[model samples]
Target chain A: MYWNADLECVPLEQRRELQLERLKSLVRRVYENVPHYQRVFREAGLRPDDILTLDDLAKLPFTTKDDLRRTYPFGLFATPLRNTVRVHASSGTTGKPTVVGYTRQDVDIWSEVMARTLTCAGVTQDDIIQIAYGYGLFTGGLGVHYGAEKLGATVIPVSVGNTKRQIMLMQDFGTTVLACTPSYALHLAEVLEESRVDRTRIRLRVGVFGAEPWTKQMGRELESKLNIVAIDIFGLSEIIGPGVASECLYNTGLHIFDDHFLPEVIDPVTGKQLPPGEEGELVITTLTKEAFPLIRYRTRDITKLYEEPCPCGRTHVRMSKILGRTDDMLIVRGVNVFPSQVESVLLEIGQTEPHYLLVVDRRGPLDQLEVWVEVSDKVFADEVRHLETLEKTIQRELESTLGIGVKVKLVEPKTIERSQGKAKRVVDKRDLYNRDK
Target chain B: MWVKQISVFLENKSGRLAAVTRLLADHGFNIRALSIADTSDFGILRLIVNDPAHANRVLKEAGFTVSETEVLAVEVPDRPGGLARVLDLLHQAGINIEYLYAFVSKAGENALVLMKVEDLQRAVDVLSAQGITIQGHDVVHQI
Candidate 1:
């Protein structure tokens, strides 16, 4: 299933040698052309020449997302604006969008990695890929589109929305590969069930789902409902969009294309690199990016890395499923909540459906968290005391699990919105839009 | 005798109870007796209506989580110790009362106490054996 056999299975020593060369050249180029890198390097009392070996990468200043924001549109471009063939930006919900540029070669590298991503998911030229990731400013749709096209697969550029039409296209085109966020995949499966579309008619065999972290329970649910192997693809717009790494058919871990991008795990608190198999924030350094070369870019996504050789025979290092992001962690009354924690609890309870929404608000001086969960129809039909008992059980389990008091609201099925794209799990109306406010 | 009761889950919001009552009213449901059990976060509106099935279906269709429960409706004297005497009989029989609420009948003479117990059949049989007035559905509707 390897797309580029020679590059994907390159010998470890040869890969490291290639990485070192690319890293050195990237540093030198950024130092000469990008003013931000130059200033940061000088402030850190370092030079591009100091990074002779891979170990000296520690001496290079780490680039936070705030650095990218400060740089804005073209401040970090290693090449001139004319040489840049394309530009992409992150879906900036809060403030300014973090922009990135891609030269002609950068697009080629992105396409190559995407080809490898789809190939790892067992997609081929014969398969039709329906990319449901939203197109336009968001990179997901085009990222997967380029790779699927590069893989010689039939690309159905059916971006997000129009759920019924997507299903119809799946049946009409005999789509074999689905590319979208995992949440959208679940929503599509639900729509498929409601529409009474014959699942067997659509020849979907694999789903490349990413852009958000999803649970293994969700993966199983998708597999059973859609009758497809749901694969996780990880990427960020700043790095190169949806082709950074992908889980192979083995479904073990996401194998980072280390030759293209060097990956490291570091303790988010201390900003020190962690040993393999330690859970920490992911930091990436672009090894061969031309338009936007980043050095030790703090990913903020929390996960561990494994160096053990995978059965899939890809020599690249594999990262564990993204646990949660440091920024995505919600602190309620001093208790931290990752939406995945509530999701895991709901999955563990099993009596209720997996769909839930966490609504956090402030009442007077105390922060309140309410979990609106959809129970099974049978369970909802039971006695009110039983429903109350279920609520108490969930509250007790959550309080014990999250170490904070929570209120549980038993909602009817399908009351929570089914996201056409990434599911919005939390609605915090604490009114602290700004600290000064 | 067992009376069909409908319990609707209401979030502890300002207008939630009003909304449910309005929905029932719009559908022409005559609420015979009602009691609310509440906590800080939510309230359960336990209701006795003219048509339990119809009320439950309409409320459920309106997206309210409603469930049907069976409870005993007993005719307690309007005077003091009338309710206490029934409680004493139940206490002697070891029938644990989960909850109970009363409302004056149309005659404004006898008070009808709607009661829920852990063992419905046992509570009914124990009370009936002592010649207590247990109202059936027909009598409850007329009242």
Candidate 2:
């Protein structure tokens, strides 16, 4: 029922003690090794010996992706390049990709946490797993691959793309588990439906979907469409790869491996930590990462964290699926809008496709929010007024959800670009306010 | 009693309307009557083709958003008051016409008025009881 049951189900007090010890060592290591943390610590007037308990973690300066970028390649890595065994990076859309290094020990810990994640999703070593996440600099493919391997499962490393072959191997290999982003999973479902393969022949039972913020509605859509229980596995390259937390079969909350990674929720506006159950940006502190140990790194993902006894009996704290990321939030006419909120509204309306693009443009002084939604066959009406009413309905729902008026445009099906990795849901054309400055 | 109207969604762009008609023409479809209801950004090309099922299937296969609706095709008097008389009767009967278009029948000066109503059966009954000629499904091809 458990992988590494002792650590997976460690008692709360014992886990806290272990975390404190690891935190102290990590703080000392960073202060002595990385000059960035050294300067940050000196600027904050702090010493490694001052971190006597977990609460002292708040005293440390927060790290961000920008900090990683400033460091560029291997700048923030605690250990020397000789000690690091491997490295993986995120594909930053604009700037340099955020780099993450793993020593031999760090790689082992990633596998350990990911193995627990798969186990939490009800994956057994006997199950044959198919990993479709792209395999290069991205952490998703190798991350899940090594974990599935560590779990002693038969792995079919069919990295992303080539939908026909993915489905063919999915059937031929009798893959019991499917791992990829939720958007890719939807694409698979569409192609699989058109392929007309015999569904009874494929042994697909569970899906591990992640790498982007997806609504529960999409999860339900995939579940009913694929006839498999879809699980959301959360991770970022800056932290560890796709195993920071995983949703159990209970579908309640994702059990965060808090013993190895300490998580704190802080108000994105004030940067003050919020108590449990209050949704805020997540900040993570790696307790066991050797090559790159971050102190209170701001994750920018908004979610509520809960510390309670899960029904599955895993002692780790649970976090809800990310509601939205602060980086993805749009400020339109003094109102904050998240694309996930728009997605939820569209899915709830039910006839439109889950894919949508939010275009924000400034036509004079006001920021105009325009949403492009794909009109599914079920929603297309024969009359002009029929479609106009649909547009108005979507506009009203989006207005009520986002607390601001928005223009809704119904586009034809398959018009919006389908992404193979993280789906691009926004196009901001508004010029920067400070550019003139 | 009823006629099938193929309504296609088209972007408000030049050559898009041509594209739809050309595709239908390539497939040997005869568009008997058509009206385009357009806005600033898009338009709905409502067509009354000789073969609506074939037209709809063809348009959809060509990646055009197509929808099928049941509209009543009535044979109206060719005079100036011909169409208004039928409309007056429908308005008096409390039957709302969501939209309507007309085309002069080739067989006579009389025109065929295609009216799309929310209640197909109610509109047909109201018009029939008032002595109006509601054309059959094959009326588009014949007239």
TM-score per prediction, in order, is 0.61, 0.60
Give the winner by DockQ: 2
CA shift at A75, candidate 2, in angstroms?
0.6
Across A224-272, the per-residue lDDT of candidate 2 in tens digits comes to 8789999989888889988999999887788889888899999989888
lDDT of 1 by residue, A1-437 (tens): 78999989988888888888998999999999999999989999888889888888878888887788677778889999999988977633223567899999999999999999999998999998999987876788888998888999999999987888999999999999999876668778887887877767989889998876667777888898889999998998878988999999997789999999899999999888899999889999998899999999998788889998889899999998887676655646423466777877776777888888999875543468999987554566434567788888888877766656798987655668999987878887654221110
- Regions of model 2 farther than 4 Å from truth: A329-437, B1-143
Q: Tens-digit lDDT track for model 2 on B59-103? A: 888877889988888878777898888888888888888888886
Residue A116, candidate 2: how far off, in angstroms?
0.5
Error of 1 at A409 (Å): 16
What's the lDDT for all of these models? 0.82, 0.84
Candidate 1 yields a Cα-based lDDT of 0.82
- lDDT, candidate 1, at B11: 64
